[model samples]
Target: MASLPQALPEPRAAGPAERPAPPPVARVRRRRRPSGEPPPLPRQLRASGRWWLGLSALVLLACVAVVATGTIRYVDVADTRVLQAIAEIRSPALTAVAEVLGLLASDPVLHAIWLVDLVLLAVFRRWRHLMVWLGVGLLVINVGAAMATTLQRPRPFEVEVLGEWSGFAMPSLPVTVLAALLVSTLYSLVPPGRKRTVGKWVVCGLLVLTAASRLYLAQDHPTGVLAGVVLGVATPLAAFRLLTPNSVHPVRYTRARPAHLDVSGDRGAAIVRALRDQLGLVVTDVSPFGLAGSGGSTPLKITVKADDTVRADESCVFGKLYAATHVRSDRWYKLGRTLLYGRLEDEKPFQSVRRLVQYEDYILRLFSDGGLRVPQPLGIVEITPEREYLLVTEFIAGAREAGEAEIDDAVIDQGLGIVRRMWEIGMAHRDIKPANLLVRDGTLYLIDSAFAEVRPSPWRQAVDLANMMLVLALRTDAERVYRRARLHFSDEEIAEAFAATRGLTMPSQLRRMLRQQGRDLQDQFLALLPFRLPPVRIQRWTWRRAGLTVVALAAAAIAAYVSAGVLAAPL
Candidate 1:
């Protein structure tokens, strides 16, 4: 073979050719200012100069206009006639509109709105907004009363009537209330983006409708009604703007404490003495039960005194006692089912006493019927005009119990079993947590069924189970807990339940504990496992005789090879 031609000698490295350096980066030149030049004024200050002067001038003009209008009072009979004509032209449409507006203006509607606002604010913990709304409502009512007295304007003497009236004619109270309500409503419904255009039109429409109703019903002269409407709208708006955030008054209730009074003296004796004096329940002795607990909403419990009963029917004594001056804070638990507290001691006949008593009694009976343990409700009593009401129930005697160091596995199993039973009965305990489950005499008792409802859904059940698991996992091994859960539940079923609970699981508690202890062990183990497996199928086959012959030849060759190997090894 001919030798391959010698590979061409590698080219020698080229000598460094001189490279031109990059052109020097161009320097940014700085412009020089005149030596004696003064600094420019800020844009905001320049803009403000003309704005402030214009605002002052406009306000001065408004003041002048208001004074001029107040002094120059000419009854515009011609304008009144024009309004009447317009009203007649749109009488049918106006009547229909009035009916809808009238519903809003009604006392019941306003009261309902007030109650709803109160409940919402309370639920959201917006104490400040609650006070603001309450103050605004009260101020409106007061202003209406003041204007009715001050104006002393008479009802219209010439127009046909359409509605009933009882209040003073001038600056009509109803019309004033309607105006204030319309202003407040418009303020609420109109947002800041559309404040100028949309809000103005809505408010104008309300004013027109209100004025028409007043004129049609002959409740007041056009001048008086118009004046009332203006004042009602203007005063509240001004107050809202001028009143500092802290000016509004808030309602609060008092809680009695031991430090506020001498418990050994007659003064303190008077607090619990009412049990035997008024309610006919006897007190054997008084003992301090530590600090009273309240839910921060409605009825504040303070310095509860345990009393012994004279008769077997009298299980305990309860009463509304005066507050001791030492306690500075307000504490109340707004009971969801009923309003059981908040009243003066001197008032006669409790308000809504029957409803309160009925609910208390009904709750006790339901718990008993449902095989759920609960404190026995003895009776409910309300003292006269002072709306103070009391519900006496059998108290579960015990210390403030500590949660068990470890949740019994059996208890967890039983609790879930109970939840399943509850579903079978078409019911659900909406609020299920460790705090509501009582461990008395080694038995589990579910308490606080106030949020219970009739419908039990998979989502609800899952949440309930997840919450229970979370409570147990706080004091037990998560893997063990999961294994126990899997014993009774299929993996897929557990996964579905876990999904419904939004991924809340016992492993979260483990992670939290590890973090607290400064440990870094990664959570690599899986908690939820799938339950169902894919199906398997078997196939049937038909074979010809040729396939059998091939199988027989392969078997004979394997046997012959094995026999030859054995003989060769022996020889």
Candidate 2:
């Protein structure tokens, strides 16, 4: 037992010398920074600081100079000189040119010219540019009016007016209109290649003819017409320069991740970067929620934390996607899953399905401002390469199944109130299923605003109301639901709504289901028909009964007063 079959010799520990020395550590070479050039400033502050300061100072100086010059008065010699020039050009040939030009400058002709230009712009898909020109033209007119008012200048005393005139006539209307036409025409013809050279010449010729016409018609002095041309040309040219594409800095939005599954490539990395930059969210993890819809909607989830902690009820994340793909099957499924699964505490997905997430946020802000109860919207974030967006909204808690009968009555009433308010604002929630209604902390809230449309028709309003009624009836008796509805609306109005939605057969279907309970709802249903029914008279009879009660109370009070008076008189 002690020998134990001579256990194997204990292994000897290797001497320190026997263990090989650790492999020589590799040294990493540090790259040196370049010596000559300084680090560049951020793009936002790239412009020379002194240049901006100088420019601003110059603008201020120019404004001061203009105000000073405008305030100083001269002897009105310019006005006198203009009258003298008008008197000198009273010849037949010049008169004829002026007359014809004046005729072209008339309101009817000007309107026709504007219409033609508008049509041409629309056809050429240059409507946006055309609108800019039109706005400039209006601005020129307004400026001319202001100038005339400021100068308080009168028209030439020599002209015998053929028509009644009102208001100051220093910057002549004909001159202003003609100037606008010439400038706008030039702007349109130029920069679109030299195809409109003939048109350009025609416009120049017309400008000359119109100036002559103003002189001939004696509606404006030569100087006033000249001033108009100067002002008009200056205005549109300034507007064109200010509004031209070259003048506007291109806004480069970082490419966002695809919201739906992109089988074509790896967009996940790009999406992560976009989420961080655009949405200011640090996405800890991202995973596929589910497959795309048959159409194109894909489902996905993104886990993220805000750069800064957000308010409990406020949105900390925002979902974004291209407007073109927002409602498509692939995008919708992904977006829906994100909203349902994302950790939104008090935020909501926006209702505008056609606008970008940024624009939708703007509209939602407006809705909130208008006292509409809506989910708080968080800023929109783009997930990179995938073009998938994450919208972080206030997560609504305690969402009960719409079909549950035990839903709070106050919640139902609040939902009805929301519908009424929607009607008051000329809107309809097109999708009004119970799933869209949420109850949290005993307060009913409406969600999923993507289907909300403005100024709904009577039929649409009726349908919306009917849908809510149907949903309520599904969980409660029709009689009880109707009584609750009547608290906010008249019986006749409710009946009319039912009639309007009869084609949907929603109310009928609900009533048929209730028929199994032996409830005589046929009378109530008939009362809701468009045709006149005895129930209408019965409703009025109930009102009369209330009136009778009021009269009996008054009589009792009068009799009691008389009895007390007789006893006090000791008759």
Query: Which lDDT tens digits does candidate 1 get at residues 460-531?
Result: 665565555544454555565566665555565445555544322222433344456452222211233434
Across residues 1-571, which tens digit of lDDT does each residue of candidate 2 receive?
Answer: 1121232222121011132222121212323325563221111222333343354345335434544677322323554555556657677776666666577767657666666776676665454466676676566666666767765656556456433345566566556766676667666545533544566577767778777666655666565666666655556555554443311111112242333434212345555555555545565555553232111233334555532444432222223233233444324443443333332111234443334445446545544544454556655544422223444444443445344435545655765666676677677665565555555566555555554566766656766776676666566656666666666555555665665554322334344444555554434544543453222111122333455456767876985574344223210
**What stretches of model 2 exceed 4 Å from their correct place?**
1-272, 285-302, 306-363, 382-392, 502-571
CA lDDT of every candidate: 0.43, 0.50
| Model 2: per-residue Cα lDDT at residue 148 | 70
Q: Residue 231 deviation, candidate 2, in Å?
A: 61
